[model samples]
Structures are given as structure tokens and as C-alpha cells.
Target: MEAALTGSLLSLSNNLDTQAKAAQKDSQALRNISYGILASDKPSDFRESLDNVKSGLEYTTQYNQQFIDTLKEIEKNENVDLSKEIDKVKAANNRINESLRLVNQLSNALKNGSSGTAEATKLLDQLSKLDSSLSSFRDYVKKDLNSSLVSISQRIMDELNKGQTALSNVQSKLNTIDQVINSGQAILKNGKTRIDRLQTVLPSIEQQYISAVKNAQANFPKVKSDVAKAANFVRNDLPQLEQRLTNATASVNKNLPTLLNGYDQAVGLLNKNQPQAKKALSDLADFAQNKLPDVEKDLKKANKIFKKLDKDDAVDKLIDTLKNDLKKQAGIIANPINKKTVDVFPVKDYGSGMTPFYTALSVWVGALLMVSLLTVDNKHKSLESVLTTRQVFLGKAGFFIMLGMLQALIVSVGDLLILKAGVESPVLFVLITIFCSIIFNSIVYTCVSLLGNPGKAIAIVLLVLQIAGGGGTFPIQTTPQFFQNISPYLPFTYAIDSLRETVGGIVPEILITKLIILTLFGIGFFVVGLILKPVTDPLMKRVSEKVDQSNVTE
Candidate 1:
């Protein structure tokens, strides 16, 4: 049972390590794909093109209405209208905005990295159809709408001198309209090609990801059941083994007196039969003279042995020597092993070891407090027209991040300067604390900034999970399977790990790794906060309305 249990533990540990490496490799693929998709700048740049086209179309419709009003003033005998084509142009620009929105959704999905392959692929399909429709829309606007506007422009220039201004206006708007449609044409062209190709790319990405997850679970499945069996043996079956050992000793003691009595009885029977055996040998000797001579020789041999036994009691002294040797070495006979323990990087005390966990905890709490108290949004009514949504979020976020960093500074510095927790590299410890603070601040602030109240809830839930699975006070593997599984993704896992390094001794490789992962987490959320503020504005507004109605909310 002991061997089985130890083997099961080793297997689980090895598989977890292998799985971690495989996950890292899969993360690389996800990183590459995310970079490729996001680097295209489809959403940001296309929004610019979309804005240009939308504005141009609105201007064209406004001027065309003026042209119609002027024509009505002069042409009482005739009816001249171009509203249908104007409406078609307007409708095309609206459809183009739909494409813009789908691209935004695709870009946002890409930000989710490998976890969002299905969502990204679904959006890719939608965008492909939207792109094709956009191409047709641009064609209609370019050939049909532009020609209609030109015809009206020429008729006004030729027949109505008073409508000459309207002709020039219509002609300039037509030029603007054609230029915008051409821009849309280029966007749709590239968008269609990329969206179609993304489907193939997604499957390859998903395959690599699945391969990563599968290839690393070598012994985990086989040993997973055995681990429980071993645990059961130790818990419920171990006592039976102990009882057997006890019963063996008790049985030896209980039967020892009876066994000694049987030995005495056999000796007595042999003594009682000795005289008869001697008489029978005498009778045989009478039958054979050679037997009598042999008996005389045997009697002489027995007398020689008795004379030897009397010589200095040598046999009894030899037995006494063996008993003395046994007394000297009896403990070794019962138990024969010595064990030595070594702690290469010893923590000074339990509190010193727990310092890392508490320090990380303080940083998280600090960041959480800042986001909860201060609004992530500036809510700047005066600057509403002057600033974009991203700008407002970023500006307010800067202040909240500052507060959170100061909180990290106070807690980490206090732990060293006041608590006097054991630390090997105080500078790195302080820096890491500040770094975790920035990340926590970004994550929490971004959540609030993006989701209003719900984001705070998310941050709180993270705090709860990190506290349990952070591998701070207890080893993460010793925790429940759920916490063990989530342990890697917890924000504080790396934080506490790195802190422990600083507390005991630093491993450069480990420090650098934790540095990279923590930074990635921080920057990932920061960028998301920057990119998604505009996208979430409508949702925020709706949430804000509900909060306003529920007078209990602050």
C-alpha cells in the first residue's frame, strides 16, 4: 500500500509537470494566432473607413434633399426625383457599418486567445458573408448611385442657372461618395480573403491545442484510480495489517507454556523407554557375539563424550557468550535504519513562510479596494464631447492604478520594515509586489471600467479562488483537484511563488518565468481595457440605468 501510494503520487506529479510544458507550447500557438489576427488592424482602421463613408453618405443625402427642394421651386410643370437612389446609398452605408461591427466582434474574440477558437471561427464565417454583401453594396453605390447623382448634376448645370450651386454641390458630393465606396471596396476585398482563410487557420490552431492537452497525460489516467485505492488502504485497511502483527506476538506468548510442556513429556517418555532399549540390545548381543563387541565399543565412546562434557564447562560458557551478544544488539534486530533531513533553503519560521501569501493578499486587496471606491469611468460630463471612451477609461484608470500601487508599496514595504519577515532579496520582493499591484489594478479596474458593477464581482471571485489555490500557505497539489487545476491560472499563484523565492532564495529561471507570466496577464488585461471600453459603452449605460433605478446602489 505504501509503495502503491508513493508511486501514484509520483505519477500525478510527473504528469502535471508534463501537462504544464504542453500547455506552455499551446500558449505559444495561441499567442502567434492572436498577434496575426490583431495585427491586421481590421477593426480600428476599418472603423475609420466606415466613419468616413458614413459621414460622406449623410452629407450626400442632405445636399440631394436641398437639390430636390430647389427643383420643386422652379419646375412646376415637371417632377424630378432621386430619393430612391439616395435611400439605396444610405442603406448601403448602414450595411457597411454592420460589417464594421462584425469585424469588431472578431477582433474582440481574438483577444480571448486560444480559449475562444469557436467564437472567433463563428464570427469569421459571419464576416465572410457580410464582406461579400458589402462588395455588392459598394458596386451598387459606385455604378448606380454615382451615375444618378451625376445625371442630376449635369441637368442642373445645363438647364437651370439658378440651380448651378446645387449642381456643384451634387458633383462634389458624388466625387466624395465614389471615393468612400472605393475605400469600402478595398476593405471588403481584404476582409473577405482573410475571413475565408481564418476558417482553415482555426482548425490547425485547435488541433495543436488538443494535441498539447492529450500528449502530456501519459500516466495520469492510469494512476489516478490507484491513488484512491492506496489512500483507502492506508485509511481503512492499514489497521488490519497492524492487528496481524499484534496477533502474531500474542499467539507466540499464548502457546509458549503448552509447547514447553510437550517438550517435557517427550523427554520423560524417552527416559522411561531407555532401560527397555538397553535390555533389548543385551538380548540382541546374546544372539550375536559381534553385536556384543559393537555395544562394548559404543559404551566406551559414550564414556569419552561424558568425560569431554566435564572438561571446564566449555559448552555452557559458549552459550553464555551468544546470549551476551544478543543483549548488546537486540535494538538493531528489531529496527535497523537511520534517516537524516536537510532543508537547503530553510525558512526562519512559519510566519516567515506565510509572508509571501499575506503580501500577495495585501496587494490584491489594495487593488480591489481602489476599484470599488473610485469609479473607473471619469463620468466627465464636460469632457464628454472632448474625449473618447477609451481616453476616459485610461485617464481614470491611471488614478486608480496609482492608488493601488501605493497600496502595494505600503504593504510590501511594511512586511519587510515592520513585520521583519525573512527575505533574501528585498528589492526584488518590493518590485514584484508593485508589479502584482499594477496587474491586479489593471484587471480589477478594467473589469469595473468595462462591466461596471459586474467587473468588481469578477475581481472578488478571483480573490476568493486565488486565496484557496494560490499555493501560499499549503502546497497546491495537496489541495482538492479543482483548486489544483485552477492553481496555475490564479493571478496570485506566480506572485506568491516569486515572493517565496525572494523570501528563501531566488532561482533566476523561476523568477524570470513568473515575471513573464505575470506581466503577460497584466498587459493582456490592460490592452483589453483600452480596446473594449468603446465596445462596452452601451452595456455600461444600460447597467448604469438599472443601478440608478435601484436607489440602493451608490
Candidate 2:
């Protein structure tokens, strides 16, 4: 458990580090783009953008410098031979700097749109080639880092296992002494003296545990610090490193249209200088083919290293050591470690909370509605004789709607019980219930309408969609934007949102609007079913007749 948690934390920390660095790079790029788009003069804008590119280049240079420092530190402490990796990183950093310089020259070509149109075009092609090369270089660095981290983790785990075995031995002896005393075994006076002797050895055992724990803690932080320092070194010293990689990627991704527009403008500006522009493009293509593969390999190495570090056990061992020590402290209740982050998230209060009640009510109401409809309609040759289509629609709709509404109420009531009617507003709970009711009605009605036969299939689909898309464990916003857009269309979305707000103090920003939209959709569908009742009956009849005809044909 400790190892797994440590792995998770390490992964999160690594990802966070990546995101932070990426964010910083993106920020610099954004500033550059913003300044370029809003410069007082055309020349000034070009100048600012060039400066931005320069800053990025400088950052990358600093990152490389730091990487060198970390390599030196690692060599000194771990006796690891990282000369090859260090040299590769340094060389790549130098090339990246050269690329940035070329990119800056291209960026400076703005008189109105592009001053050095032919030159800028040539530079872009050169930068693209440079970009690919740098990517490969980074990959290699990342891989080396991973191998180093894996080595470190294994060492830490070995230390922890040794400590645990030593502690367990001490504990077993202490327990034996206690059992002897409790049994009133006076003949075991020598055993009692032996137990006293064991006390003298306790301190040594303690030293071993402390040494292991301290070593793990100190070493884990150092490894992380090294990774950070290395990242900063490359990022700070080599402005071109990130500019050619992340900034370029983001700009290309988020503003392809803008890039194309600017590209066309530059081409037009250099119409008189077409030969220079074409030559630049050809040179860039050639460079990409020749150099990018090596750079890409390097980047892959670096990324692999990053992932290994993120999964290392040094930190996890330290945490476990602390926990075990606390457990060993007799007569004192240990404070529990907060593993909430490691646990499943968007946490539902299922065990002793009103949430379970709400969950139960919703399921029960759905089940009852389904069963009632199936059983009621089972014996009928013509339910139409006793009821008009509109009446049938109204009766069925009313029954289900009531069931949905009541289920929502039951869930709300359960929430109240679990929360003990806390200080949080009950209004949110009510809203959740209402939203849930609407969602259930729409979903049930839709499934019944579509399936024609109501049984286990509709229930399964509803449950699966609810679990996956209902925002139970993870917010739909983190999902694909397509799902983010579509989740609100799901009934469970509102139920989770509103209930979360009421019970968990997670009031949604757009709850009112979402509820209104959901309510409208629910009402609209229900009304549509009413108007289309005659149509549905005839369709059902036709379907039955077709089935009977098939039977006859058979």
C-alpha cells in the first residue's frame, strides 16, 4: 500500500512539475504573442517578439547549465558515470541556442507584417529542422534520467525492507517478555533478565530504523531537487529550447489559422525575394531529414527518465517508515496519514451517508416503474380499448413522473440524514432532487420509447452511462471537450452537481442555468410524448402485426 501510494504521489509530482514548466513556457509565449499583436509600432512589435524569443532562448540555456550542475552532483554522490548523457544534453542545448538565434532573426522581420520576409521564411524552415533535432535530444536525456531513478528506487526499497525486518524482530521479543510476565512464571527470572538485556539493544534497533528512515527521506528530496534543477538549467539558459518546442507547438495548435494567415502575408511580402524564401524552405526540409531523428531519440530518453523518477520508491519508503514508527509507539494513538488524494475521488458518502439512501431510492423507483409497466401491459390484447393513446400517454407519463419526483425526494431525505442537516443550505439538496427527478423521467421515458420492450437492457444502459458519464468519480470537464459539452445532456450530471453542492459544499457556478435547461428538456420530451401518443400506439400495433405475419410465414 505504501509503495503504491508513493508511486502515485511521485507520478503526480512529476506531472505537476511538467505542467508547471509547460505553463511557464506557455506564459512567456503568450506574453510574446500578446505584445506582438498589440505593439505601438510595427517595428516595435517585431522587436518585442524577438525579445520574447530571446528570453525563451535564455531560459533554455539556464536549464542546460542547471542540468550540468545536477550531473556533477549525481556523480559526486552516487558514483554514477553520466558523462555521455551530460555531453549529449550540453551539445543539444548548444544546437537549440543556435536555432533560437536563427528564429529570432526571422521574428525580427516585421515592418508592417514581415520585413525580412525571405529571411523569415528561411529562418522558420531552419527553426523547424532545429526543433525536431532538439526533440530527439531531450528524449535521450529523459531516458537516462529514468534509468537513474529506477536504480535509486531499488536501493531505497532494500533499505526499507531491512529496517522493517529489524523492527519486527525487536517487537517479537518484547511480546514474548510480556506473555511470560502475565503467566506468573517465577521460574523465568533469567528470562526476565534477558528481556531487560533486550531493552539495552532497543536503542541500537531504533538507530537502525532512524538511519534508514532519515536516509530515505534525505535521498528522495535530493533526487527530486536534481530533476528540478536540471529542468530549470535547460529552461533558463537555452531560450530556443522551449521556444522551438512547447511555445511553437502551442502556437501551431491553437492558432493554425493565424499562422497560415501570417505565412501567406510573409510570402506576399517576399514576392520580390522568392528565390531566398524557396531556398530557406528547401534547406529547412533537408535539415529536418538529416538531424531530427537524433534529437527525437534524446527527448525520448529524457521523458523515460522523468517517468522513472516519478515512480521511484524513495519517498514512499520514508512515508512507510514514519507510519511504522508511529505504530510502534506504545500507548499513543497515531495520527492517520491523509491518503484522500490516493483514494478514489469525487468521493461519494455511501457507507453511512444519505447518499446511499438517495442511490437506493432512485434504483428502487426505476425498478418499480419498469416492473409495473411491464406487468400491467403484459396481459393486454388491446390496452387501447380501456384507454385512448393520449390517456395512455398521460397515465404512463404521470406514473413515471411521480415515481421520479418521489425518488428524488427520497434521495434528498437520505442526504439530510447523512449530513445530519448540517449548516449547508438544504436548498441545493432540493435542487438536486428536482434535477434528478427530471433526469430519471427523461431517461426512463426515452429508453422505454426506444427499446419498445422494457427489461434488463434499458436498466443496464442507464446504469452504465450514469456511472461513466455522470461525473461520479471525475468531473466531466476533465474528460474530452466533446463529453464536457454532452454531459449536461445527461440527467445524472445535474444530480451529481446539485447533490455535491448541497452535501459537499461544492456549489456549482452555473447550477441555476443547468437546472433550468434540464427542466425544460424534461418537460419538452414529456409533452412531445403526449402529442405523439397516437403515433406511438399505431407504431406498436404495426410492429406486433409484423411479428404475427413473420410467425405465420414461419
Best by lDDT: 1
lDDT of 1 by residue, 1-554 (tens): 22332333233324323332332333233334434444564423333333343343344334434433333432321235755654554454444345445435545554444334454445445445544554564556456644554554444333333343333443454444435444768757655654443243223333433444354355345445544655666678668878998999999999999999999999999999999999998888786876767878899999888789769786687567667888645765666576688988888888889998998898888887777776676666898899888878878878887888788889888998999888888998898888888888888888888887888899999999999999987998899999999988877998888888888998899988997998888899989888888999878898799889999776
Off by over 4 Å in 2: 1-387, 418-423, 426-431, 449-451, 454-462, 477-485, 506-509, 545-554
Candidate models: Cα lDDT each: 0.66, 0.57
Model 1 earns a TM-score of 0.42
Tens-place lDDT digits, model 2, residues 1-554 = 23442353244324423433443353345344534444434444465656655676667667666656555554543356768757776776666566566655556555346545455445555555655655565455356544554554455345455754544444454445434435547536545543443243223334444676654553455445555655665567556665778888887789999889999999888896888989999999988998788799999998888787668965567567767886544323453353445432244434323452345346436744664455313245576577766666566666666667776676667556765544255766665666566556655564465335542366566566656666666666777676677676666666555555555455456667656666776677666766765676567667767877887632
Residue 228 in model 2: shift from native, Å?
99
Give the winner by TM-score: 1
| Worst window of 10 by summed lDDT in candidate 1 | 70-79
Q: Which residue pairs of candidate 1 clash?
A: none
Question: What local lDDT does model 1 show for residue 274?
Answer: 92
lDDT of 1 at 126: 46
